[model samples]
Target: MAETVAARLLARLREWGVEQVFGYPGDGINGIVAAFEEADDEPRFIQSRHEEMAAFEAVGYAKFSGRPGVCVATSGPGAIHLLNGLYDAKLDHVPVVAIVGQTARAAMGGHYQQEVDLQALFKDVASEYLAEVNVPEQLPNAVDRAFRTALARRAPTALIIPADVQELDYSAPEHVFRQVPSGPPDAPSSVVVPAEDQLARAAAVVNAGSRVAILIGQGARGAADEVMQVAETTGAGVAKALLGKDVLSDDLPYVTGSIGLLGTRASYELMRDCDTLLIVGSSFPYTQFLPDFGQARAVQIDLDGRMAGMRYPTEVNLVGDAGATLRALIPLLRPVTDRSWRGRVEESVADWWSTVERQAMVDASPVNPMRIVHELSLRIPDDAIVTADSGSSTNWYARLLRMRGGMRGSLSGTLATMGAGVPYAIGAKFACPDRPVVALVGDGAMQMNGLAELMTVTRYQDRWTDRRLVVCVFHNNDLNQVTWELRALGGAPKFEESQTLPDIDYAAAARGFGVDGVNVSSPDELGDAWDHALTADGPVLLDVRCDPEVPPIPPHATFEQVKETTEALLKGDPNAWRILVQGVKAKAQEFVPGRR
Candidate 1:
């Protein structure tokens, strides 16, 4: 039998080092499915419960491996379902390639079943590259371009392969048959070196400032050592964006944990007072946390010049790789002898940790989510890959978890979507089979999509490279974040029944899916549950009964937010006053040093 275009395309993917493609099988993709069957196990196709999970899994794989993740789906809704996860990759700036099946070429113009313009559907999300393989000969180059564009741009790229084209026999061009090699060509090396003038100006700004601060993002992942060198040389304290959590160790004296809603007081103060802000590879959206233009002169380093001054007015914009730019500037930096600035911030971070520790130790009736995360932080392997859902669980993960070297994770960076935690953990396991993978998800988010992924986990639990996967469910019986947001933002009572959830026996559900499960009610139970999950040979789900009334208070609360809290208290939400009081206490710590 002659080779099909689908076979040729799959071969290209394998040649490009793709280990797996997360997707579902459908009539639209029968040819591609056949190709998978024929290839045996070259690039394993993971069957996902939902198309969104497939995309999210791909995102998780890419985040852990730093390689473009691949996902495939049938045309129309299957391809449409990928938008949320694709947007996760787009917003987070991770690389992903999506292969979408289409109707036959003849049927595309006709109103055939499941026929929609795949390119048009993906145009906005896959801005980097979107192509339709119309002719049989276009398969090879389109596949190559899709991967290359996805990698170089660090964005999602889509290739729409029509059913007719996929089924067509593959034929090499006469010239290509004679000249082309059997293996794929090596990817071109791309090193973006900043202009000397730009680097010099950036160095000058840092040297001139009496108080310098560095904001590192995901782009600076590979430049951690260089970032530290620069931070120490300039006596600058480093604050990390959420996605950049693993770039530096939280144990570093000058390092501040995640910045923004879940930010530390030390970090907020550092940004408030710093004279020079050195932003490396992060386009942090919350400009309120950054020093104002008049407050500090900004120097930013990013490969994309467009994002240079997008967040803040820049004195120097260096378009280069974060590690490369920092490496170049290190030699020119003059070390600051007076360490008072960073020393002060370091002290603040230490005190803040003390406050956090106290909060974590609170033995309440309903388990404190903080306590669960704290224990997990203490017990998790140094190299574990942790994924948190986009709600209260993220706040806990951000505030409590300390990322060490070799440990990495991700959330819905920009989209801030829920339901990615379980898929991300599963994908992370596939990417780094030896590393322990954990998903921290709230009951709300787990109900949204995580529960379905448990079925995905059970089916492929032992088949993955690493069999150690744990899902920690914060079974609070409420959409806790939304409940708090109503009080904190709108001065409203938990307005509707929509903000709450039915109590789910997640542990029982896990057992139903053929995985190990446990329910933890108290602090002691929580600790023991962690021990069990950490040591379990297969996938385990820890259904932690967390406090629904506890609020995810921000580091700094505004007067308007205070008013809302007061209103909620008046409306008889029992937790409102306690949350308000806690916010007051945290903010008060900013003024009086060494006072809890």
Candidate 2:
């Protein structure tokens, strides 16, 4: 009796610490599935309804557990479906390993049912791309390399196992396990920025300026102290992007809150009042909040090349890793004895915050989205992990939601695609079962992919992790925000009739999958429903009807966008106002729980 090549490979994957491999089974990868079944190895295989769910589940697992998440897909479309999750992982810098089964060696270059250039299709999305050659011995190395690249680069990797090679016989190597470093990658550039003079000059501006501000982004993830040091040095107020929220403590003295479309007025006003703005790791796309002209200069630093000057022109653009760059800039910054800079920004933030309390969060409507948003934040426990779907949810939660220590979130800032929240939430929960997990999604965005994840969560609950997470759905019927955006851009708003979705009963949809589902329409029912679901032992969902027209538009969107949407909506020109249908009437959803 001889062992097949697939058995040997699956054994190696098990040794690599993959606990549960997510994917749909097929003839192309039958040998590997059988190997996974037979091998006395680490990961057990789970069949998903769709290949996208497989990759997405793995993504959730990788993000929460801080390990390499694994997924297996057959050739052609199965492999292609992995692309979106792979892209999400690559862009967001999560480690994921995808095993894609390829066509047989005999069928090389021939059109096959489940055969395509798997490597080529995946190459763009993976940090490392590999295909097993005819030689069976070469597979372990490719797999090993892919595993290494995914974790080391903090991105996704794809391995294509040719169908014929799966059955080839080979000797298994000794010690199949390898552990990659879990820390953030080394700072991109070694040559430090010699900003002694610039730092001093900037420090002087900070010292004298009436107001100073800090904009933090993804690069600041691990540099909380360093970022705080910069803010304290100049008494600059801090505002973090959706991804950078975890880095700075919410109670930090100089922190002014968040800014964006869903931004807090306090943070927005603090930024507007700042005489000098120091951007740390953030190249946020919204330029409306940036200072039009401050006697104070702007200093921006990042590891990525694209972020430099992507928005407003930078007074100083220092290209280096964020952690290292900030350390270098620290010594150059002069300490300011006077607290004027801090005082001014703080006052502005306070005044603006008062306005929000009076307006957005004050005595409000029966359909107030802010009321739902604020109330949910209060109920979510500190250790829960959350992922947000696109549209107003992304904006509202990014700016308004408050996360304490131990709570983290997943961001799709780069692609900003809809439906990612559902998959990302599911993926994160799979990775950290002990912690509660939540997926906050608008009704439209949830429909994009939430239905696919229902079975996966139901299967895993009480069986694998036993932790029941929450999927909070916002049922906002109109495409209100998108319609408005279209109107802003010289487009008509007839998209109202064409793109608006009928209100869906999300709780009913979840109930169909054997998960707990609660529908709440009013304030009182909403709180009671959330309380009941929070105590349940399995995955539960709370579907609430959030107001569709509540998302605050960015203060600075062009007049053209405003005009077009108005004409389109008023004139009944759906075609002319088509762009406005993109994200209108989005619901804001949130979850408060640790993941699997």
Candidate 3:
């Protein structure tokens, strides 16, 4: 049989070493579906419950695998449904390639059924590279460019294929005028390093300061040792951006936990007291959390020159790979003789951890949300991959959970979207089937889209070598994050109509789909429940009834924020008394002599 464009596309993806393409079936992609049957699934088509979930799964796969994740969908609505997930990839700077079916060439402009302008829809999200393949000759170059552009730019790219073009017989571009030919699928590798003069200048700034603080993000993942060496040489306290939570192990004495709003007091203190700042591979946008402007001299090292000096007024912006750049700068640095700064940082970190443990142990009406993550921190496997959702639970995930050994963790960092935890875990499972994957999500997110993705989990559970995927749902019956935002940010009380969530038995829902389920309404059951789910033979969903009133207080809460919360409570918050009691107990831990 003559190779169709659809068959050629699949073959090219296989050649690029793509094991699977996360997507959904539709009539517009009939040719591609048929080719999958004929090709015997060389690159498996992992069908997701929704097109958005498919795109998120691709993003998650790319994030964990360090390769371009591929996702496909049908024309019009299916293509539109992929926007949010694609945006998540774009904002987070993940490499993903999306292939979408379009209307037949003849019916595109006629406004045929399920026909829409796909190129326009995808332009912003896949701004790095967007192509429409109208001819069979355009197939190879389009697919290849999509992958290359996505990898090079570290952003999402798109390929729009008309239905007719996909069904046409594949043909190679002739060696003639105006013909384009593509090279092999291999991407050229190189280590980028900044000029030696820039490295010397950066080192000079570090050498001049008596106290230094270092901040790292996902880009520093490969240079963990180099970052540690820099910290040791400069006597700097290392703080991680939320996305770089696993870049350095929290077990390090001078390693402060996450920075910014969902940050530790130690990190806040590190930033407040430091005179020199070194930021590597991170574009953390919250400038207020950084050392006050002009209070310190800062240097930023990033792969993209465009993002180098945007966050803070960095004195030297080094555009190079983090590992290479740090390696170059290390030789120029002078080891600090004054150990007082290092000692102070270590002391603060120790005090902060003790405060965190006490805060987690504070009493609540049902279960304290902080304790949920604290328990997981106690027993999480060294090699596990953890994913979190965007909600009040995120505060616990950012502060309480500790990363160590080969453990990796991530979420929708820039996008901050919910309903991604489950799909991200699913993607992580596919990326590293041997490693255990756990998703920390809120009950609101569970009801939003996670409940449906459980079927995706059950279907593919047998394919994973180690079938241990734990979805721990923080089953607090409220839109807890927004509730707090209303009180703290807007100075408004929680409106029940908008804040209340319909309570559902998430465990029963999981059980109906043939996955194990555990319900924990008491804090006492958390430890055992986590153990059971973590060691399960297949996917397990833990429905934990957490206390919604337990405040996700900022490490350094402002006076205005406290005043606003007080005002909101005085204006008749339904859980006002309980909220005050829990907040006091949680905050009081910091002031306790032994605990602090």
Each candidate structure's TM-score, on Cα atoms with residue i matched to residue i, is 0.96, 0.84, 0.99
Please write out the lDDT profile of model 3 over residues 388-416, one tens digit for every residue.
Answer: 99999999999999999999999999999
Candidate 3 local Cα displacement, residue 99, angstroms = 0.3
Lowest lDDT 10-residue stretch of candidate 2: 587-596
Predicted structure 3, TM vs. truth: 0.99
RMSD of model 3, in Å? 0.8
Residue runs of model 1 more than 4 Å from their true location after superposition: 174-183, 572-593
Give per-residue lDDT, candidate 1, residue 511.
94
Q: Give candidate 3 misplaced runs (Cα > 4 Å).
A: none
Indicate the residue-level lDDT of 398 in model 1: 88
Question: Could you tell which candidate, 1 or 3, scores higher by lDDT?
Answer: 3
Residue range with the least summed lDDT across 10 consecutive positions in model 3 = 587-596
**lDDT (0-100) at residue 191 of candidate 3?**
86
Off by over 4 Å in 2: 1-3, 127-132, 171-211, 292-296, 304-312, 315-321, 351-366, 463-466, 555-565, 572-596
